[model samples]
Target: MAKIYDFNYKYGEQKVVLPPGKYLLECWGAAGGGGCKITDTNLRSKGGYSKGELTLKKETALYIYTGEKGSNYAPTFNGGGKAMMHEGLSNGETLYCNGGGATDIRLIGGSWDNEQGLLSRIIVAGGGGRNNFETKGGDGGGDAGGDGSKADSKGTQTNGGKGQVGLDGSFGKGGSAVSPSSRENYGGGGGGWYGGGSGYNAGGGSGYVLTENSYKPAGYIPTKEYWLENTSMTVGGGIAEENGKAKITLLQGLPFLVISSYTSEQAVFTAGHTEENKLSKIEWFIDDVLKEAFTTDLYLEKTINYTLEDNALHTLKIVVTDINNMTYEKVVTISKSIMPLPTNANLQDISTKLTEIGEGFKNGKTSIINILALKNIDSSLNNTLVELSEKIKALFDSGDASIENLMNQLIQANNTITQLNSKYKYATGTTEVQKFSGKANMYGGKYGNTFDRNINDWIKIDNLGFVPNIFYAEHENVTVNSVFYKCVVFAICNIPIFSNEQDFTIDTSFSKEKLDNVDFRAAGIVCTNNERDVYINQNGVCIPASNNYFNLHYRWHAIKFI
Candidate 1:
């Protein structure tokens, strides 16, 4: 059975630590409140609805926030705006109403009520705008927010705009009505990725979806007809009611185990799974006897020791189980044999065989032993040449012609092994590359800063499982001395991605772009690439820049050959 997490109307953001797996996220926003003294509640605008798929690389935290229904007295909870009121007017006599709050799901570093958290919002459902005495509030949904009936203005991707007479809105916060000399009051705007515009009647908020691979629902109001086509569900489909709600469903796959290698002494194995957290346990067995058990870990290693004088076939097996109680197993067989100690009788038998060989040579009977007869021995044995040398020495001491043939065969075998080893060292065609991407925050130091660089001026990324040879990095929207600047940084290390570096070249090129009052202009400036400063380390990659007294946030993507 799939795991489900449901959330209702909440005042603040809640935390959910999801296991490593794929999931489906569904959200619904709240509806706006009607104007003061207006009993016809059906005129209130409906909130937006959003549903999509989300994937987690590991166990991650997801911040969930549900919207609150708008009321005439106070501001709506969770990013809603407050209704405007004149100094001399009361609530019952006012013509204003508050906007509804939005429901959203935020990824890493997402915080409620913070504009900086907008960068982490992956899915959002916009709230409806408030209603006024003359016109109705706008309905929330679509790529952009809907305009109010009388406002004639809407919310955009960045920020909200003002209508004929209202205050402008910012990210995640709705717009409010403007103050005037008259006694009249206007409605408030809705909350969303970008809040709606404020006017006589407010505009609805805009919905947003940011996912690598996802399916967007067809209609603004989710229906059973479209839910069946969009997701794996055939039932339970609808929009949010007065308050907002959210649901998360986890997707699971079958668990598997692969035995990488096994010997009479030790065994090594790895589990096959994309979602590492889904695996529950691993059991190791030798000769059908359980040896060790591991919990919630994929890698398995065990050591087996044979008993005294034991010469028999041994068995090694491993079983893996998932959270769903599904199991998979693999088995391998190995042999354990020991040679017996030489005794007096064995020595006498060896002496007799040597004497017989000498007598046969004297009788003029030439016993031509074929070199191919030795092929029955294990070819994988590394000591094959040493054993063959001992046999050739015995035959040569007896002056046999077969010794010359054996010596020639050993030379040919050694040449074949040398050729195979050379090909294996340089063999290459196509290989998959492992990818890693993340954001790093750095502070600038003095120019040409090498050893005296501040600790915060650079970032060292390690435990990446493998070192990166190629890097694509860029710092955007960096505010330096009250000016927003963007720069692109690209680097390549010429060496094996997974191997230790002896002598490597690091070529780093950076391009700067300046934005003065939104008029973007590109300026090409080549930064010197110093190998002593920026080079691939045995642990991972270290990235640094030569910016003086600047604080910047950069995103980087690294790829290494698998």
Candidate 2:
């Protein structure tokens, strides 16, 4: 036994520089103190990795150095607080976490058993993409799933052993026809080192976390009138832990800023692959042709990054370009999901995906001075188009068809921008609209419409064939002098699946939590256009539009197609 840091430790349990004397270090496995071994010179076990520090010395009577952690439990890896080694370290002493984190982890004189914990960082590799529509699930990615490391074992990966990240979707054309329950038959993303993949074919996975102290901010977080989609963030370890075969090896220090909820309407596109002098460099291919080659650095964070239309599904392929330009192509597909429309949309919506607006305007074309959100009319955008169109009446009543055409253009632009922006916020710009250079329309791929996996953004409709915006026939116009032909109105209604069910769970202090389910519907209105008036009594039919949310009613007029 030796007196190190004034604490008595068993032989071989820790190593030290000697007076050239023969001494052995003992084992301090789980059998040791429940976690960090504690010598029971007085009886009973104590000491834990939670907040324990170690100090070591040599037999020369002169202090060789502080004892680096020797695979002890309390000081497992990221738990080493202060007084850590940074440069020269003893056989069992180490400083500076390899992955870049609070200097934690130390070397044990014993063997390589705990080497995985000795490193400062860890990386959980991605799992292979899942297969839907007749495709075998792609093999879990190398190191991507973080299985190369050992700590990710089941028996070993306990305490949620830091799961692997799900892989990106594959671009390989998933078989036609949405596979059973899949929204899109796109290949699923592979599991990465930290997250679990979505169970359903095209689902996403839950992310994992490993940190110095813990991942969450201490205490209760209050919810407010927030539009933020998600706000949780976490740091990760680098060592990919392995069990007998090394399960999720957490490489140790991976960068932290990249953790995101990815909730923006527009999502950026990114591609990544492991680096090194392997079979050559990895490369990317859009459809078939090569785009980029991979390198050893490819394994590092942020290999590829670009903003893409949110709610749009995209397919990309990656291949390793050898020094000879030989290719090892791998497919990666990225798809974005639409955020539920906000009752009152505003700036500062929190999302994991970064979104960008087109070069034009915040609310779309300048022609549309009014916003659909302002019009209170998703219910009205697709309606017959012109029941109570106040703006339409203003247009044609002037006896100028040109003005009527312009008004129709404005409505079309507003509706189109709303739906399109809601789907692909990145495809358009948020810059304010200051002027209108005349009438404009949108076509092909513009306004983010496409059948192929490649989703397109808004295109300005200018030339005879090109209009940045398109008109809704139901929103057709009948200027003052123009005739109003009676047409049946098929309007949409907004309903509350459940009226606010206010549940009050009271203690000494009363607290009320109200849960509301908002429901929207399209109900056919057989009334003639002439009978379309705000007063329900004048119409042959009437339906309740009450869910009681701020009066529970939809505004804006339904219209008739030209």
Candidate 3:
């Protein structure tokens, strides 16, 4: 059997001197004041509360600070008080509990700022938000705290929202905001831990009256009780009894759990109880069935590898039980698809091959046809590279690809293509200019028997020079309905079939929609010493609309002379 002692504090700093041996410590924060309205109406919010345990040795002095309630004011809303505890006196490594914000028509409940280092292990309850004509007050703050009260909008006398009740039975409710029958009537009072008071002369409701004493509300119960015989002792407003039973208090803080990293194949997570020493067991579960249980420690670190068959979401849960049979549980949902994991060596090989192919194309040592003809390469590797490349390209086109993964795959593909190109070399020869003819058509016009010269003789040998460059441009600045001005411009460039030797024939025909004027015509291809220019005419006038914004589609065919 162990001897136990309990001490409680509120409103200020309390210094306690203890004798040697192990002693458990517990604490709670203060509540906030109500808001002040123009008509002597007061609306207040409750403060947050927290509890934790600490072990102390003999002759140790513990410093405790209980926060004060928020002040009631008209211009600014008051914030809830903060509770804190620290060892020694210098305020080093202190634990803090934040207060709630004052009630306001516009502002929600006050927030809790957990102590920096102790946030992971501390249980904090936030103050309730304000309730007004437009919105309800915010629910009590914390993971499992009670919901705030809802606004009663039935008539002039609307009930305020209820405050949330915390695990320790602490409650923070909203004050009623009753509409005044006349300009002289007062508003309702804000809600507190006990409850709200009724409005004065039609004022807002006063804080809920729990016990006869306004200082002590209901649900403020001691976590542990100690009975000492023939001794006089005082604890936080209540007197210590001389009962024979002494209880040990275990400090419970908020649970901290997180998923550090996750992928299609595996997920790594970590979970722990704030009070490490009090933790008795940690159990891991998936979807509901228990997967494993750890009984040695209070903390949990695990990695789960799962198979994703349909790419559906999965749930992972962790349950932690303390020495006092108190348990905390958390669950996380993960969604991912199975992705092929390529080795670094394989990626490097592919990258090397792609580089070779790129260099071969750049130096004109090989063409796309030559590289496509290579054989004896790994089929799976090639397919994987192609799939990755297409997926990466599509992601970029849609503006959704992860850049790091895309770049890595692209580098590997580039290397693989380079290596494939090294196995084949196409014969290189001089490029001879060849004559060719093709037909060009547009939405409202056509040019027949157009002739051009191909600079690459391989275009005739391989019959692979029929690439087209077509584009459309609009001239919104020039507002006119005529075909010469307001109409869209269509242009064609880089027609591989061309001739510089003489003026080639270009018979033109225009549809009625293309040109309202029958006299509208186009200048056939005109060859120059350096370049060629094509022109169009409306009403027998040559319109230099080619330089303006216009749509163009250019393509050509090569007559391979085998």
lDDT per prediction? Answer: 0.56, 0.23, 0.31
TM-score of each: 0.44, 0.17, 0.26
Best by TM-score: 1
Query: How badly does each model clash, as a count of residue pairs?
Result: 0, 131, 70
Give the poorly placed runs of model 3, Cα more than 4 Å off.
1-157, 160-251, 254-256, 263-265, 285-291, 297-300, 304-317, 329-562
Worst 10 residues of 2 by lDDT: 26-35
Give the poorly placed runs of model 1, Cα more than 4 Å off: 36-40, 72-75, 86-96, 109-111, 150-152, 158-161, 212-241, 253-562
Ranking by TM-score: 1, 3, 2
Q: Flag the better candidate by lDDT, 1 or 3.
A: 1
Error of 3 at 103 (Å): 5.8
Better of 2 and 3 by lDDT: 3
lDDT of 1 by residue, 1-562 (tens): 7789999988888789875556788877777655554456556666777777765534567789887866765778766667766556655463437777878887533447765455557677777777776456775654566678655445555567465367666677678777565576666777776677766678877766663233333222321221211422111121323887789888655566655554446556777554547678888776567877788435544333434224343445678788787677765544343121123333233334333333333443233222222223334432453354456445644775563454464555455455443333211121112222322322122233323222234434555444555655555554345555555555555544333423322223232334334555554322222344444545665555333334444566666543
- Considering summed lDDT, which 10 consecutive residues are worst modelled in model 1? 425-434
Of the two candidates 1 and 2, the one with more favorable TM-score, higher being better, is 1
